[model samples]
Target: MTAHDTATAARVRALVAEELPRLVGIRRDLHMHPEIGYEEYRTSQVVVRELSDAGVAYAAGLAGGTGVLAHLPGEGARAVALRADMDALPIVERSGREWASRTPGRMHACGHDGHTAILIGTARVLARLAAERTLPHPITLVFQPAEEGGGGGKRMVDEGALDGRHFGPPVDRAFALHGWPDLPLGEVGTRRGAMMAASDRFEVHVSGTGAHAAWPHRSADPVVCAAAIVTALQSIVARNVDPLDAAVVSVTVMQAGEAMNVIPDRALLRGTYRSLSEETRSMLERRMTEVAEGVARAHGCTARCECIRGYPVTVNDDGAVAQFEQVARATLGDARVRTIAAPVMGGEDFAFFGPHASACYWALGLARPGIGCPALHAPDFDFADEALPTGVELMCRLALA
Candidate 1:
C-alpha cells in the first residue's frame, strides 16, 4: 500500500475512536423511539439537529417528508455518496436492555438505528477533514427514510437527491452497509454481483356463485378454487423455474368464507414473489396468473390477479466492490474482509441507486461474544454497540478513499 493511503486509513481509525461514545449515544436514542417506514418524522428531526450542529451543509425533506441529504464538499470533482436508512419496524421490543424501545409495538429490529448512527459518525469525521482542508473529494451523506417498505430511495432520486448539486458532479460511487448478526464482530461480508433479491407482491381474487352448503351442486365454491390455485402456484417454482435458479413464491394470506353453513362468493389470496433475475420475476408473474386463471376455470369460477412490483435486485458494481475490499483490507487487516458465497433473498431499496451510479453494499458484523445473535425483524432483535467503531471507520475510509 502507498504511504498516503496508510496515513488516510490511520486518520479514519483515530476519528472513529474519538467519535465512538457519541455514536453509541445516538444509536441508543434512536432505538428508544423507533418509527416505522415513511413516518420517520421524529427520526429525521434528530438527524437534522446533528448535521446542523456539526455545521455540515444539508437539505432537509429531500425525497418526500422524511429523507435528509447532507453534502461535505472537498477539493476535487470526484465524489462519493454514502447512504443509511432511517426507519424502524413494527415489532415489540424484547431485547431486555436498559435502553430498549420505550414506544410499544415499534422497534429498531433491523439495525437502521445503528446504520444512521454510523453515518452520522462518518459525517463528523468528514466535517473535520473539510474544516482542515484535507478532504480529497466531496461526500454526500444520504439519510434515507422508509427503507422498510416505502421505497424512499427511489423517492430521493425522483426529488434530485443524487443530482450534481449535492455531490458536485454526480456521485462516482455509492456505498451502504447493513448490520449482520450471523458474522463475527468487526467482520465485513460483501460480493461483486447480486447480493439481494427483487421483491414483488401479488393478490388473487376468485369469484363464484354463493349458495348453501347443503345444496353443494348448485354453488360453485370459490374457496375450493382458491385452494386449487394456491397449490398450483407452488408448482411454478418447483416445476416451471430452473432448479439451479433461486426463487420464492409464498402464499402468506388467505381470506374466504365467514359463515360455516354457506359457501362464500369470493376468496382472496395474497403473497410475495422473490427472485434474483428479471427473467425469473417475469416468468413467475406469468405462471402465477396462468395458475390462478386455469384453476378458477376448471372449478367453474372466475379469477383475477394483481401484481405490484417492489424493490429490484441489488447488484454491486465490480469496481466499487474492489475499492471497498481494498479499504477493508487496509483498515481491518486481511482476515476481516471475506467473500459471501450465498446471496440473501431479502430485498433492499438501495437497489434503486444501482441504476444511477456504481454501488457497493456490505454487511457489518454485530454479534456479541458468547451470545446468540437474533435475526432481523424479530421482537428481540437489537443492534450491538460494539460494532459502532467498526462501522464508523468503514464509512470514513470509503468516503475518504
Candidate 2:
C-alpha cells in the first residue's frame, strides 16, 4: 500500500478505536435483552434511537414488521445498502457472561448483537463524513428483523426496503456480514459464488396395519418400513448426487409406536436437505420422495412425503467480491483478509437479496488464538467483543467504496 492508503487506514482505525467502547456497550445491552424473529419490537426501537442519534433520516415500521430503514444522504447519486440482522435465536443462554440473555429461552447465539452494533457505529462514522461533505455516495442502512428462518429479508425486499423511495435512488448494490467462529479475530473471509447453501425441509409419514407381536405375516409393520426408508434416504446424497458437488440429507426426527410389543399403524419421519446447486437441490428433493415412497411400498405400506422449500443459495456477485476484497484488504491489511476456502452448508435469509441486487455477505472472524470460541448456535456461544472494531471499520469502508 501507498502512503496515502496507509494514512487513510490509520485515520479510520483511530476513529473506530474512539467509538469501540460505546459500541461494545450497546452490543451487550442488545445481547442481554434478546428478541426472536419478527418479534423484534424492542430491538427495532434500539436501532431507531441509534440512527436518530446519529442525525440520519430513517423510516420505521417497514417490512410489514419491526424493521427499520435509514439512509445517510450525500451529494452523489450512487448508493449502496448495508444490512444488519436484528433477531436472536430461540436457544437459552448458557454463556454465563454478565450480559448474557435476560429473556428466558432466547439468546443472541449467532452474533447478531455484534452485527447491529457495528452497523450503528458505521452509521455514526458515515454521518460524520456526510457533515464534512466527504461522503462519496448515499448509504442506506437496512436494520432487518426475523432473519432466523422467518423470511424477514424477503419481506423487507417486498416492502421496498431497497426501493430507495424515501431514502435516495434505489440501491445499486447490497452488502451484509456474519460473524464466523472458524476464523481468528481481526480477519475477514469472502468467496466468489455459492457462499451458502439452500435449505429445504421434509416430513414423511408411513402407514400400515397395527398388530400384536405374535403376528408375523398378519400385519404390515410401518416401524420397520420407516426404519428402512430412513436408511434409504441417505443414498440420495451418497448415490444420487455427484461426488464433486455438496448436499446433505439428514433424518433428524422419527416417531413411531409408544409400546414395545404393539406395532403402531403410523410412523413419521422429518428432516432437512441442503445443497448449493439448484439442480442438486431439486434432484435431492425428487429422489428423497421416490426413495421413501418406493421403500415403503416394498414393505406393503403406504408413505406420504411433503417437502417445504426454504431459502435459496446465497450467491455472491463476482464484481462485488472483487470490490469487497479491495476494501477489506486496504482497511484491515493483507494479513487480516483471507479468501474463504469453500462454501458452508448453512442457509441464510440474506440469500433473498442476491436476486434483487448485487449482493455479498462476508464473514467476520470472531475466534481467538489459544482460546477457541464457541461455535455458532451452540448453547454457550457468545459474540466476541474484540471483533467489534474490525466489523465497524469494514462496514464503514465498504459503504464509502
Candidate 3:
C-alpha cells in the first residue's frame, strides 16, 4: 500500500476507536425516535446539532427541507461526497429492546438511523482532519432524507445540492453505506456494477359495465379481466425477457368489488417492477400495457396502465469500486472486504448520485453470531450498534482516500 493509503487506514482506525461510543448513542437515539419520508424534522435537527458540536460548517434545510449538507474542504481540487439516508420506514418497533421506538407504528426498520449516525461520525472525523490540515481532497457530507420510498436523493439533485460548492464539478467520487442483516458482522460486501435493482411502480385501471349479479351476461366483468391481465404480466418476464436478465413483476395490490354479490364497475391493480437493465424495464412496461389492454378488450372492458419510474439501478464505477476495495481492505483488513458476485433486487436512491458522479454504495454487515437479525423493512428490524465502527471507518476511509 501507498503512504496515503496507510495514513487513511490509520485515520479510519483512530476515528472509529474515538467515535464508537458517540456513534452508538446517536444511532440509538435516532432509532428510538423515527420519522418517515419528507417529514424528518427531528432527524434533521439531530444531525445539525451533531455537526455543530463537531465544529463542521454546514447548510441546513437543503432541497426545501429535511436535507443537510456539511462540507470539509481539503488541499486538492478534486472532491468526494459521502452520503447517508435519513428516513425510516413506517414500521412498528418489534425488536423487544429497551430503546424501542417511542413513536407508535414507526421505526427505523431499514437502518437509516445507523446510516445517519455513521455519516455524522464521519463528519466529525473529517472535521478533525480538516482542522489539523491533513486532508488531501474536499469531502461533502450529504445527510439526505427520504431514502425509504421518496426519491429524496433525486430531489436533492434537482435542487442543486451536488453543485461544485457542495463538492466540485462532476464530483470526483461518491460513496454510501447500507447495513445488511444477512452479512456477518465486521465484513463489507460490494460489486463493481449493478449493486441494486431499478425500482418502478405501475397502476392498472380496468373499467367495465356494472349490472346485477343475476344478469352477468349484460355486464362486462373488469375483475376477471384484471386478473387475466395480472397473470399475463407475470409471463412477460418469464417468456419475453431473457432468462439471464433479472426482472421481477409483482402485483401487490388488487381491488375490485365492495360487496359480495354486486359486480363492481372498475378494478385497480398496483404493483412494482424491478429490473437491472433499461431494455428489460422498457419491455416490461410495454408488455404490461399491451397485456392489460388486450385482456380488457377480450372481456369488453377498457384498461389503462401508468408506470412511474423510481430510483435507477445502483451501479458502482470500476475505478470507484477498486478504490472502495482498497479503502475497505486497509480500514477493515483484506480478509474483511468481501467481493459480491451478484446484485440484489432491492432499490436505493443513492443510485441517483451515480449519474452525476462516480459512485460506490456498499453494504455494512450487521449480523451477530448467535442473534437472528431481522431483514430491512420488517417491523422487527433494528440496526446493530456493533456495526457503527465499521460504518464510520468505511466513510472516513472513502473521504480521506
Output the number of the lDDT-best candidate. Answer: 1
- Candidates, ranked, lDDT: 1, 2, 3
Tens digits of per-residue lDDT for model 3, 1-401? 78766766776678678988888888999999999998999999999999999998888997659999888867677678889999988777788988899999889999999999999999997787677656878788889989887889988777766777554443668999999888889999899989999999999999999888887898999888888998889898889989888999999999999888888899999999999978788988999999889889999999999999998899899999999998788778899999887889999999999988899999899999898578888888889898888888778878877
Q: Kindly report which residue stretches of model 3 are placed more than 4 angstroms away from their true locations once superposed.
A: 2-8, 165-170
Runs with alpha carbons beyond 4 Å of true place in candidate 2: 1-11
Give a tens-digit lDDT track for model 2, residues 161-280. 787776788887899999999999999999999999998899999999999978847889999999999999988888988888999999999999998888889999999999998999
Across 73-104, the per-residue lDDT of candidate 1 in tens digits comes to 88677678999999999988999988899999
| Regions more than 4 Å wrong, model 1 | none
The TM-scores, one per candidate, come to 0.97, 0.95, 0.96
Which candidate has the highest TM-score of all? 1
What count of clashes does model 2 give? 0
